[model samples]
Target: MHLILTGATGLVGSGVLHAMLTTPTVSKISILSRRPVPMAEGHAKAHVIIHKDYTNYPSELMQQLRDADGCVWAQGISQNKVGKELKRNREYIEITHTYPLLFARALAASTAPKPVTFIYVSGEGATTSPGRFTPIFGVTKGRTETDLLALSKEAGSNLRAISLRPGGVDPTHHKEIAGFYPQRTGIEGIGGLILPVLRTVYSAMVSPTRDLGRVLTELAMGDGAPLSGRGVEGEGRTVTNVGMRRLAGL
Candidate 1:
């Protein structure tokens, strides 16, 4: 299968990239990033595309993406990174909602013979409900999920969209890949220690980075039963961390 991946430099994206590169079934991988990906280097199947703009896809880029069978969208930013409230909200909406939606819409309009699956790496607390205390991150991500699912329904057999909502993604499970990024410190460092305990006592609260990557790859390759509505009814299109663990057989 040919696949397109975004945010290949991030922890989650790096894990997914590793899974894709190692899997024999995945024949080609198109990596979209602002800069070159180190892990993709020297890999024969990896194709790095330096795309500065996510909201706009040039015709040439669209043509290349049209040939792919699926996309694993891992692009996102932490709310704490963007300074000030106004700028943070704007950047969050653009990155979390606008970018992936534009890409999905473009692919849904394609005339490819086979169906294109889009796996969105969403978080656990994302919700569409409006509230006075709701965070902008949750609102944008929830809206994105709803819009992507609606688009999939409209596109029917041509496009399929699935959202994986994971909480506290632990990167320590795959040190070989996670080592590429800087070590977590402060609150993140503390969370890392507690994540393993959560995995054993309450698995839904956390997911190993490797497991998340493998499950995303499985969904992208259309090799899992969950893609066929075998999971819980009404929520098959959206899988929780618990479901992800089950699919990954962890």
Candidate 2:
């Protein structure tokens, strides 16, 4: 199947791209990005579309997207950059919602609105409840989730939608991105080391970034399950070294 995706440059997205390339059923992939992703030694049919602005992406590109079976939306800025970065959390939400909506609309307008599922990547603690305080991000993600669900309902049986919410991603990186903050550091790092212990003692749960990616890809290729309002649970999901070990076995 031909798949369209966003945010291939980011840490989480890059992992998603890696896993997707090996999926036997997924032959063609169109990654929406501002810049191209440099592929590893071998990957087949990974198309990078450099569309500068989703808001103003040409109709030709939209047509190209509609031709694809579905999309994996992994776009948006991080919450840590709220005060420091040029674009804040709210803008992040807008872009996230807008990009996916464009894909959904394009799919609906097509003559064959086949079983094209949209797998949206939200964040941990994205509230279903209104008026929660979560560093402005709660507001942004909450609204974005609401919008995606609404889009699915509006389409009725025409579109299938699913949401993934993963927390504290630890991308396998050699060097930290100069100024960017790592998700788990010092105390958080210490926490990761002893997390499996805590899990055994207190019955805790977490996930590895790779496992999260695997789980997401699994969800995208839905297993005869009907679409519901449920977002895939990844709460308290820390990508610790042990989780990494567990994933290696899989």
Candidate 3:
């Protein structure tokens, strides 16, 4: 299967990319990033595309995407990374919501080799029904998932959209192969040190990067059947952390 991936430099995206590269079923991987992906360099199956704007997809780029069977969207940012609230909100919405939506729409409009599958790498806490204490990140991501599912419903068998919600993705655990696993620092590093304890306490809360990657790859390669008009927590569409672990045989 030929797949398109975004944010190949990030923690989650890198893991997904690694799985794609290693899997014999995946014939090609198109990586869209602002800069060159070091991990993709020298790999015959990896094609790195320097795309500056995610909101707009030029005809040339769309043509390339049209040939692909599916897309694994892992582009996103932490809320704490941005200093100002206004900028953070804007960046979060654009990166997490707008970019993937635009890409999906573009693919839906064009002809494809087959029904295109779009796998969104969402987080655990995302929800459409926001309480008084819900974070802005969750609210935006939830809305994005809702919109994507709605779009898929409209598109019928032409396009399929699915969201994978993983919590506390542990980057340390993966296949003993060449892959991009970033060095954790600060709070993330500390969390890595106690991952076993966290897993014991909250088994469903932590997802090993390898497991998450495998699940994403499987979905992209059409492991499960299409959605049966279910809601966001549908059988084939939305997968939680526990679902991911189960899919990966963890």
Candidate 4:
């Protein structure tokens, strides 16, 4: 199956890209990124699109995406960078909320076959409800989840939207990217110890990033049961960390 992947350079997305590259089931992978993605060298099936703007899509780009079977949206930013970063609020909202919604609409309008899957990478604590007390990250992500689910249920739409909420991702199996990992610090060092302890205890609060990637690839490839049996309409569902673990065979 051919698949379009956003944020292919990020931690979780990079893992997904790696897993898909080695999987025999997936024939082609189109990575949409601001810069050329590393580790895609010598892979004939890997197609890298160095897109500078996420806010807009040219007709030609849309045409390329329309031919794909599915998309995995792993683009997002941490809430901690709201004001400290340059216009990060807008950037976060654009990447996390607006871009996915727009892409979903375009894909839905496309002539691709029915039941096209769109997997969105959300967070563990995201809520469907937004309020004044809600953090900007949660508010934006929650709204995106809600809207995507609604879109899935729309008549004549062939999109099946699924949200994955993973927590405390363990990046041991991931390749080292220059700016992906945080600089070593006291708290970061402590997390190193804590992650191993949690894994030893089989804590469900954390998930291996590699496993998360595998689960997403399985879903995109339709490796399991049908998403729904309710007529010909598409479906929407959310998978938490535990569900992701089960899907990952962890």
- lDDT for each residue of candidate 3 in 50-147, tens digit (9 for 90 to 100): 99999999899888877788888999887655556564467878888999999888887774436788899888899868788888788888888888
lDDT (Cα, 0-100) at 26 in candidate 2: 77
Selected candidate, larger TM-score, 1 vs 4:
1
Off by over 4 Å in 2: 40-42, 83-90, 155-157, 172-205, 223-250
What lDDT is obtained when candidate 1 is compared to the true structure? 0.80
Backbone atom clashes (below 3 Å) for every candidate: 0, 0, 0, 0
Could you give candidate 1's per-residue lDDT for residues 105-194 as a string of tens digits? 887676355678899988877776747777877777788888888877783447788888878888865876955554667666776788
- Clash pairs for candidate 3: none
> What are the TM-scores, per candidate, against the unseen true structure?
0.90, 0.72, 0.89, 0.84
A best-first ranking of the candidates according to their TM-score comes to 1, 3, 4, 2
Which consecutive 10 residues in model 2 have the weakest lDDT in total? 230-239
The candidate, 2 or 4, that scores higher on TM-score is 4
- The 10-residue segment with the lowest total lDDT in model 3: 223-232
Clashing residue pairs, backbone N/CA/C < 3 A, model 4: none
What TM value does model 2 have? Answer: 0.72
lDDT of each: 0.80, 0.59, 0.80, 0.75
Candidate 4 similarity to native, TM-score: 0.84
Model 3 alpha-carbon drift over 4 Å, by segment: 155-157, 175-182, 185-194, 227-232
